[model samples]
Target: MNDTQSVNATSSNDTMLVTKQVHEIEQFETFGGDIIKNVRVGWESYGELNDDKSNVILITHYFTGTSHAAGKYHPDDEEPGYWDSIIGPNKAIDTNRFFVISVDSLVNINAYDENVITTGPASINPDTGKPYGLSFPVVTMRDFVNVQKSVLASLGINKLYAVAGPSMGSMQAIEWASAYPDMVPRLISVIGTVKADGWTTATLEQWTTPIRLDKNWRGGAYYDQPPENFPNEGLAAALALVTQSALAPNFFNDVNAQLLAQADGKPDLYDIQQSPVIVQWLMERARGRTTSMDANHLLYLVRANQLFLTGMNDDIEQGLANIKAKTLFIPATQDQLLMPYHLERARDMLKANDKEVELVYLEGDLGHLEGLSGIAIHSETIRAFLAD
Candidate 1:
């Protein structure tokens, strides 16, 4: 057994506490042919590991999310981890039976969060002792899995019972199944696409345009700017695109309809600069998401996603054939960002390659977000798949 001490991470109530741990690699190489030294990433685990370390289930987090997948950090915290609904004692992920692990991605956007520890553009360069900024080497989905693989290896884990994630996390999961076919035996991809299609890649680029146009962005060298001069507007705007794309219109109608008008009983439409309450709501939603986000990091994330292809292979079919894991796809039917067609293509490709694949749709108006918020509705499906 590994020498690491057991820590309680999965709980159904506030009494359980979760602690963040960091993993460092002396030097790391990027798929794009760049070298980074002293790579560090934060990770957390839920449940206990069995003998031989074979009960491990790796959970990759989505973009805009951290490594906190379940449990509360403190007794009085406002909420547990994001996926608490399906990762507890008797939940779908069933921490009682599976040792679930999650890691923070390199260049994670939530750099300001106290619990997150990641290396990225905001990290100090050991050579120059300054933030890397735009000089940071480009990273991709494959890089994420590689780092995760290193983490698992450090824990003496050579095989994963399952590798599962949603959206960007799903991309990482797919990469794991492809890159290390022998290591991962099961793949659970929720609200994911096989590859970044042309339409989706362009849309992701559009999300970054606001940040690039921001006067304070300064070609991603705005780290020295004071908080007041930070590119909050651009980051918030970019987040708004992500938020709206992940959710359906009903969310706006339900949450922002009453605030659409001014106290004077007038609509917010008289001037070109005056935005409706819904628009302002979007901005505030993004603003409150985490103001410490770096614009350069956002741009890098966009590029990483844009450059993603099935297994990073020139031929998509050959890449799909590399997967040896039994795959389960749970896609949100109303997802706009990664539409049903995207998952369909992946499922079809896996089937064409004679891989074991199963698909179940999540029916909800939350669009892409259903993979998170509406996942519990399909708990039985997940439980059965894991059992299989």
Candidate 2:
């Protein structure tokens, strides 16, 4: 498929459900020294920009999320964007009061999904006339913010009212404040931390292991061959592992136990009594992702996530000090992947630096997914923070 082909080919709607646009950057050089001749970033916007452009809020998306932030792609869409509940006219984000915008991160995994447009490993390299594959430059949160800076500039927005996001999105928010503290007045980071700790780095390594081990992976160059050459099974397994980590262990276990109880006295297979059944369910969910996701794209996202650190340098203290935006850190109480303690450390650093910062813990059972799924519970708090 060509770069212009939408990843979401299954969407039957002749018209787009959301207003998707692209910003193309010619001869963009990445932080890692690789050069992409042409870069396309998919983006969507909600509400309108005020004449002064002061009522704009940049909403960065988390890993696996798309630029579609609040609207249904079509009337038949099963659901809207990830944060639909929190962003809309008079909603928590209050689109009536602010212009909300979201952009696909560089090499966003969603690009692998049909109907989504992004320049990633799968995009045709102008230099090679083929897929970039493993040749795609490694990008950082700073690179994400830089591309977004271009997007904002293209829209004639010189300053932002606030920058907010969850998970990987939050990382970009932090980067924005550090990279351009004067441009952002406020920041809301949910279920994220300033740096990728040893635990997070190790977990990410495990997530990519399966894909790397897959014989079909071909060192991220599988695109040169046929569809059968793709690492579907490995990608599915990796996604399953991600799903397992995306939730609270206790919540998952409790639900599993309840399901097992309800299956009591049933036939051996029908009972679903074994732990393997839960594993099977997780893998099944992963299998569904394999249809819309590419292993190489996922690997790129994982690598970007692994390298996340707040400051320009490796100095966390200096990075925290440079941030002038009033910041709110919302960590999920039950999030095992991005545990509250990680945010606690960040809070301490921000406080020690005397930056305007607030720490809030999201009390929910969904764990890391709570950032998106449990937004309702924290909507009022977010609204108030933005208002203040």
Number of the predicted model whose TM-score against the real structure is largest: 1
- Estimate the lDDT of model 2: 0.82
lDDT of each: 0.85, 0.82
Best model per lDDT: 1
Off by over 4 Å in 1: 1-15, 258-264
TM-score of each: 0.95, 0.92
**Candidate 2 lDDT, 185-273, residue by residue in tens:** 99999999898989999998898999999999988888878776689889988998888888998878887777667764434565566
Q: Can you list the residue pairs that collide in candidate 1?
A: none
How many clashing pairs per prediction, in order? 0, 6
lDDT of 1 by residue, 1-388 (tens): 1223354474534334788887898889998888998998988898898888998999998888889887887777898887888887778988889999999999898888888888999899899998999999999999999989888988889999999999999899998998899998999999987789899999899889998899988888877878668777888889999899889877667767667453445455878788777787788878887465777888888888888887897777877899999999988888989888888889998898889999999997798999988889988888888886
Indicate the worst ten consecutive residues by lDDT in candidate 1: 1-10
Candidate 1 RMSD to the real structure = 2.2
- Model 1 / residue 202 / CA error / Å: 0.5
Candidate 1 displacement at residue 139 in angstroms = 0.4
